[model samples]
Target chain A: MTILFEIKKNYELQKVTWKEKDILVNTDCGVKQIRIWKDRALLDWHVRWRDEVGKNSLAVADRMIRTSEGKPWVDMGSEYLTLHDYVEGTHERSGHEKRWGLLIGNMLQAGLELQEEFSSVTKEDHYSFDACLAAIHKLSKEYNELVSVKNSLPEANKRLNLAMELKKASSHVPLPLFDSDTHMNNGGQIFNILFYRGSDDYPEHGYQPLRRLLTEWLKECGPYSLRKLLTCINEHFSLEREQGYLLLAEILTPWELQDCVVQLKNEELAHIVSYVKSFEQDWDFNRILLHCFTDWMDDKRKRVAL
Target chain B: MSHSNETVNYGPILFQYDLYPEKIEEVGKVKKVISRRGTFALKETSLNEEEASWFTHVIHRLSEIGYHQIVPLYPTKYGDYTVQYGNRTYYLMPWFAGGDRFGLTREEAIIEEIGKIHFLTLKEQDFSPEVVDHSFQYLMQRWESRQLEMERFAEESERMPYMSPFELTYLSHFHHMMRMAEDAKRRLKDWYDACHSEKRYRSVLCHGKLSRNHLLYSHHGEPHLLNFEKAVLDTPVRDLAVFFRKAVHLSNWTKEEGGRLLSLYQRHIPLLDEEKSLLVSYISYPEPLFHSVDLYRHQRERYSQIEFVHRLEKRISAMRHIRDFCDLILTPPPPQPLDTNINTDHI
Candidate 1:
């Protein structure tokens, strides 16, 4: 039988059709979206995290719809499939600023609650500034003839040195024990944040292909909006002193420039120049972002001291 | 009693079960949720993290041990037996419509279900002198303190120039209540001595709150137990005492019916002699009567003198029934008259 037929048999649904990539199933309760997963560990983590979110009255993620036998997933031969409430909405970026913060805060709280179960399935954040510096140096040597790549080398080295110092200073700080999903921001566009009428006030913290949500938000949300987001997050889950140090170290690292340098290949000279130009521009933007983080932390420390 | 506004309040919890409520109706401690999915009984209670785990474990453990007469909890789409919403924990079960068995049949069904559970989980505990001594001393100290409080109250009432109706009623039955208290202490000592001598004790999963109200009959007349939130592993006498004490409050209850119910339960697992004494000890305690007086003393302004007197009288009457029941059961039948001629010929 076809996968749709299998879904119908397992979920006891009558009408199930493919809505592009996702399967739209008409359930007795409401319309639902069916998504399939190939990895068992990831599927288990998703089920657990979503279940925790659902239980805690937190509207941070879409809960998995169980099959007739009260299972979160229906097993096929090679893959597993799950259903979720099919929310109809559009992604809006301009408004709902506080709502976005509240959503992320709740997500972090939920993640912290399921830390034990989550830490088993996911890896912690491992950042190395030296790796980025070495990759940049090799790229600069490879493209020495290109003036853009050549000019950006000295500034890139200086930023790496600053990142190294911050990393060394914060070496005593430990990474958070909870599962770290550095992919909360829906890229820079934040398109996964759906807004529909009669929908929940908080939207789902969807998946992202971007490397780190905080770095991306620094480039996209500007310093002020990012501060608002962190402030709201801290309201729900107070950031510890050690966690603040680690976060500051992360902000100091030029992850965007590192990502660009790593992605550079033996493409045409034009692409290399454009890549170097973009990397330079992102590196400058990160400087401002670093300042924003330090400023927020210093202000918070002073307020606490007072 | 359809509550549309309140239905919105319960939406998040019901949504966990994929249930869209068309209406919500409050029934005692539970909410009857009428939904497109089906009708469900949603029980909202408060249980901290540890208590929640224990409560769910008890429910699953009961089923694992082949006790299926319980009202089963429906797992949410997330496969959790309970949904924690704010400080309250909510669980869903298929609503069992009330049947006509509201009287003796219901009580008998409750007793039988309790007996079945006790029989299934009954275990002989390794004799621990520390546990036995602590239990005996703790209970002895608490019962004595309560008994002393009642005595003081009676003395204070006697000293009054003009006694209230509640005071008069309490003073009248004060002697009988004290006698029952002493009798309970004596039985408790006997139980302790028996256990110490035998170096043995048995424990079963006692339904901490046993009442006819906690049992419901299905349409097919099969009774299903509910409210195991307070279930614990304790002496079998704990449950029997709780049940019989409440049973005596029924206007039609007799020592014979109580005896018959005990026999019905005994058919599943017979109570040992010490256990019987413990049961009598738990039942004979005049704690309930003292509660009536304490209520009158503390909250006299809240309730009228007639109300207090009426409550005290009702409890006194119930205690009388318990006393009679205990006397009838604890007493052995008189020795039958011997036929001397027949006995001599046999010898």
Candidate 2:
């Protein structure tokens, strides 16, 4: 017995061909061959072509036939085909490139299953991937807005804002990919970049372009919306960070630091004050600047005398 | 002796009162007056109303035995149990001519003196069982209630910012100790109930709070026990445990020195293995009981001095060591009677 399975990509659909007692499907991306026997079916697919850009063309072939009882066999959709092809090609290019491809591939497959279960929208519309990407983008924008607003608030309020940013950041961060049943394979370069740069301590100044993108979207959200967003961040994300900050402050400064120390401290708020102090015996250049700033503030207070 | 009631004076009684003597002269003169009171000795510290009543009871009981450790110059019809100053109470007995106060010249002497006190047993004397049971029950109830109050205070301290982490830890440990004490109490009570029906040992007298102040010495260095205020019918080892803690453990006596003292005590009055085991539990529980009281009182005064806080903190830290010692001594591998007899199959 034999059964026909349709392969569709974008607006293109084709009936895969079969060979002697089997069906063979050949496409530009890969070749998939299928065979049927009494009460059993077998199928195999592999990548076979390169695109015009000299990049390996993303492809997948799923051979679908039937057993003697007419049970349908294999169905590898266009998205899985594209993802698998992308992963294989990326692996050939660089070890790091393959990691991100694998991560995204796993996520995409899971997302596809989830979409199939709940979404009335079909894969033809590409709504599932679009929705995920959109959600991540929205979260990034919200985070950027929170960081900016936090800078404007008082020290106490800053904590709430920072927490908001962290929540937004965490939600958008991609889930790690699995290699086999037990182990996770973090895509090399992509994983490193995400862990290092996408971290809470990532250089906010260095990612100005992304930050600007976030800021633009956040401005459209309105001040009230932004505040509400920050409150949500504080409620969810910033609590641990706030606690860590307070603990650091208490341990570092048993007594109030001198004006010189305070002026020097402000320049490197990047790490905790204790962490900075732990680096060297004497205060560094950044700490000196902070100390000077504090001294100046103290002098100004004395002059006002009111 | 023939007594004439016609204008008989009790001698020229020179009463010397020094609330806080400014100079050694004042104390010296007072001492002279006390010496002149014909067979009299100075009692250190003033007594409160409860202590006075307890002292009165002791003197009255001692008079009935015909040997008055308290010497009254003029024996009134009622006897020598009388108030000296409005604040301080004294009982007059026929004092030995050159009897010395039990002065602890060295730390070893203190432990030895404690051992002497523990050796005292009223094994031959008959006491009212009702009185003994009532007094023992009262103290047990007091201790139990105090533990509960300390626990509640600890729970309250958890919410306080000023409460030191050390204090919080101490309170937690203390709660554990209290639980062990409560367990011991239940077990002991069960044993007591069982023993009551069996009538094996009818009653044993205990000097509840055995301290240095309750001891006296004769010119010949013979030790005499005083102040049976908290005396009641319980295991005599309970008195021994209290004496060991208050006079031996609390003092600067070394473990070796304490062992020596214990040996001396055992020579005078032998201890059963169970009695020795129970001693550790008794010693471990009381210090915390006293400490909890102190903490509660300090909190009441709203005193936040570092010294006071540090004392409480130290006690809290010491609790674990005390508990370990208690467990090492009390919780042997042998299965408890209660544990073995309980019908675990049904429950």
Candidate 3:
């Protein structure tokens, strides 16, 4: 039987059609999006977090539609399938800036709520600044023949040193338990950060997504936009105390620069110049990001003291 | 049944089940929802978190224990038996279309089902003197206090220079009602003593609010019980008393009918002597009379004088029937009076 036939059999929807990647079906209740998942454990976590958050009228989260037998997902030979109510609004940042900021905060808070349960099921990646710096140093030496890369090595070390200072200063601060996917990035011309409902595809616990959000906002929209986002998040849930120090420490660290340098190692000898040049551009971008974040933290600290 | 645009009001609740109600009909407290998927009964209740969990547990447990006579609760698309919106909790179930409810009245079927459930879940609790004493004393104190309140009301009414029709009606039956209350207390004492002697008590999952209205029949006349909101673990006598008391007020009820109903229930689980005495005491208690007087005293403005009197009189009539049933069941037929002429020869 065809995939549509399989879905029809399981979901009992009469009219189903593909809209790009999502399978849109006109259900008796309303239009719904039928999506498939490759990972069962991930899907289980999604279902639990969504169910918990969706129970509250104040918080908005995606809810999975159960099959006739009340199972949240159907097992095909290779994949699992689930259904959801089709949301029509654009996630693009609109005039509702404050609303977007509040939503992001609330969604993160919901993530924090599931920290205990999520931590037990999945292991989170630990970030080691020393290991990252060591890798970058090794990569710069190996690619010393490339002029552009050799020229940027000192600036990279200087940035790493500053990040080390910040880390040492904030070493006493505690990291929050919740970590999930930063759903929006500034890579595109339009920032898609204002979705009305929370996504179910959040990452597992033990890592903080707030740091990623800060880094992305700083890179894509500059320091001003990042400051506004932090302000909005503080309005919803206070992250200005210990959480602030943690985010600043992580941001000041040169994880992205290390990643850029590592990627430079994979280029062909002939293409090495172009790759090095690109790496140099990214390095410069990250340096500006660090200064902007440091300045924001200093300003915040002074205001809090006052 | 009244139909209107109330469908929108319950849209969020029904939407949880992936149902869009095309038509909504009010059937007493339940909303009869007709949707493209099928017809369903959506009951909205005010249940707290704990009570909602217990209600769902009871329903699921009954099904787990192979009892298929209950109306099964349908889970939402998100897989919750109950969906909480605002302050109200909602649950959905198949409508179970009205069937040929001819053979067995709802009351009789309810009693039989109650008995089957009691038989299935009945447990003989370990003897605890403190529990027995506490339960007995608590009930005795409550009954005595209520009786005293009724006595005060009676005295107050008797002192009135001119009595209203309701006052006169209540005054006339007050003495007899008090006597029956005292008799119920005596029977309760007997039950307590029997429990002490037996060194044990039995508890079942009692349908705490037993009435005919809580039961329904399927198309093939299979009884489907619903409304287990007040279900709890208590003496088996609790359900029997609730059912018999409510059943007596029905127009077609008689002493024989009540006896036959009890017998039908007894087929599944025979009532122990103490349990039987407890049932008798519960059923014979004239709490309804006291409730009527309380209503008259506090909320008489809500109803006409004639209405209060009519309600009081109806309860009095039902109490008389209950009295007869209790008397016949509790007091063995007095030893046949000696035929003086024939007995002497036999002696």
**Model 1 over residues B1-347: C-alpha lDDT tens digits?**
34577777887787677787788889999999987667989999898667777888999999999999899999876678887766888899989997666455877898899999999999999999999999999999999999999999989999999999889989888888999999999999999999999999999998799988799877666789999888899999999999999999887799999998998898888998889889999999999999998888788798888988899899988988998999876876579998765756555
Candidate 3 clash pair list: none
Point out where model 2 deviates above 4 Å: A1-306, B1-81, B84-88, B92-121, B124-144, B162-166, B179-183, B186-198, B201-208, B213-234, B248-259, B272-278, B286-290, B293-304, B313-347
Off by over 4 Å in 1: A20-22, A90-238, A259-306, B1-3, B100-104, B151-163, B333-347
RMSD to native, candidate 2? 36.9
State TM-scores per candidate.
0.80, 0.36, 0.72
* Candidate 2: tens digits of C-alpha lDDT, residues A1-306: 223343333203243333322334543333433333221110111111011101111211111212222223333332121211111111122222232233323222333223323232121111132333343344335334223222222432333344345434554332211111111121112112211011111111111222222122233443333233323323322313332233222222211112222333344444334432433322232233233323433544575676
User: What digit string (tens of lDDT, one per residue) describes model 1 on residues A273-295?
Assistant: 67777776776776786787778
Query: Candidate 1: what lDDT?
Result: 0.73
lDDT of 3 by residue, B1-347 (tens): 22355865675576567776678988999988988788999998998778999999999888888888998899887778988766788899899886887677777789889988998888999989899999999999999999999889888888999988998998888889989998999999999999999998999998788877788888887898999998999999999888888888888888889888988998998888898889889988999988998999999799999999999999999899998888656754469898767756665
**Recovery fraction of native interface contacts for candidate 3:** 0.33
- For model 1, what is the error of residue A221's alpha carbon versus the real structure, in angstroms, after optimal superposition? 8.9
lDDT of 2 by residue, B124-215 (tens): 33445565467448757877886777777677777787876546555656666677677556644644454344433323545576666544
lDDT of 2 at A285: 26
Arrange candidates by TM-score, highest first: which order?
A: 1, 3, 2
Candidate 1, CAPRI quality class derived from DockQ: acceptable
TM-score of chain A of 2: 0.18
lDDT of 1 at B149: 96
